[model samples]
Target: MLSARQRQLDRVRTFLFGSRTHYGAVFTVFLYALLIAIGFVYLYPLLFMFVTSIKSPEDLLNPMVQWVPTQIYTENYAKAYRVLNYPQTLTASVVMSVVPSALQVAVASLVGYGLARYRFPGKGLVLALVLATFIIPPQNTVIPQMLTYKQYGLLGSPLSLFLPAAFGQGFKSAIFILVFYQTFLTLPKVLEEAARLDGASDLRIFLTIALPAAVPAFIVLFVFSVVWYWNETFLTVIFLEGGVTTLPMQLSKFAQAYENLYPPGVVNIFDRLNEAIKMAGTFLNILPLLVMYFILQRWFVESIERTGIAGE
Candidate 1:
């Protein structure tokens, strides 16, 4: 009898929330349309770049804006390479961005694990400090960090860039810590209790039980790490010197070089080259991230749902 009544309730609720209620279906359609509009707004530039990168110089310079390339000259990518300083700059960026980011994620996860799992006297205080750090502007700390790195004989080294990451000691590291803490807080308590009852040590519980449950949070952290590191322009500039410059630094260099070599609107291939090269550089810089996001968007979305907010 209860089951039949519950079924009727479900049907009524669905009907009300679906098309039966005033303008329910219209709101749903509007939401979907809004989402599509936003998606196009975000992705159109990347799409434009993919097409623009392959266009012949003549086609790109054509009087009217053509959405599609007339003849896809694949060689423009190679030509753009000369101005981009492709191979070396690419390698430098990968090392500068990727290495430190991985370190930050590791350190943040480990620190968060300890804080979440272990009962400490001043856990709240420590976490408050992390939150406080987040509120502080990074620009204020950059000079001090530079001075500290210089004192440690680590100046101008890649280690200088990654050392703070290793220690969970950078601007973004604080954000990671808060995120990990929040996610870890949402994990079921019984899992830890069960592990303890089974003669599992704290270390074993954290390593085997807690960490396994936090995979969603880990994925989110991984995404943040890779994207933040890849896009970080300021840290790359201050810590790194000429030989160890990142793509951001290299982009700035190219901009200066291009300006010095040619006046704007001169119409030479080399002169107009700067415009396309900038676009190509942006394309190359963003493509890897776009690919990663789309490929893992399902995981990203699933993780977001599990990240405590929905359940809360």
Candidate 2:
């Protein structure tokens, strides 16, 4: 009897997942398949690059159907390291990555907490302005932003990036604010009131009561910081000028060097090792972000989802 009941429950689940009535389960499956196919299509080039990065010089150059390295040459990574100057790149990447993210989280959480907890005039207007910032094209602001930074004696300074974050601005501070605000707003007001009754000032409420209660949120922000700093190119390029270069820009410069050398589809001669080194360089560039995502991706998703739910 138990076996028969278990078999019936399994069949019901299978029917719900695999069968369609007016809902068009077939269409859902079709869309999923299409998305999977497209994803693989986009991934193939990167996959090819990774494979080529480990291939020997002659094997890398051959335009044949070789997918795996005929003879693996891991030394391409060493060559890439030397060419890119990893120590300088590491130093530059670290400063820009660590500071902005920490400050952004701090700013976002504080602003979000205020927006969630405080009732004030123009609060709606403030939220509106925050949303509007997302609509402005980043490219449009780059030139003017650079000029302003220059006038303020901030051009080519990492402080320019760090400072905006310290004050509660950067990429989509509005969205992050919204996210954290929505999350914080869901907390029981009694908690804040009780803390206030104990002689906790507003600052004490924020630092001691609220910020400490937001660990999951902090983990999400930390991960976002790691990824954004690793990938930030345009703003960094504009602000840093030649004063600093992050990993992305360095990799781009490497790509441009190859493009200029071979001119892509117009050239005949090139160093096979350099091409492999480019591949190696790209792998190194993304390695940290990949590791971070793999490690903290669960916490990041959980924090966002749980917060969103609490807000609702």
Instruction: Please tell me which predicted candidate would have the highest lDDT against the true structure.
Output: 2
lDDT of 1 by residue, 68-150 (tens): 77876766566556556778777887787778877887788888878876797999999888878878887888898888888
| lDDT string, candidate 2, 5-59, tens digits | 8999877666556644433455668889999999999889779888878877777
Cα lDDT of all candidates, in order? 0.74, 0.77
Steric overlap count per candidate: 0, 0
Model 1 stretches astray by more than 4 angstroms: 1-18, 21-33, 197-200, 257-272, 309-312
Name the lDDT value of residue 39 in candidate 1. Answer: 99
Q: Best by TM-score, which number? A: 2
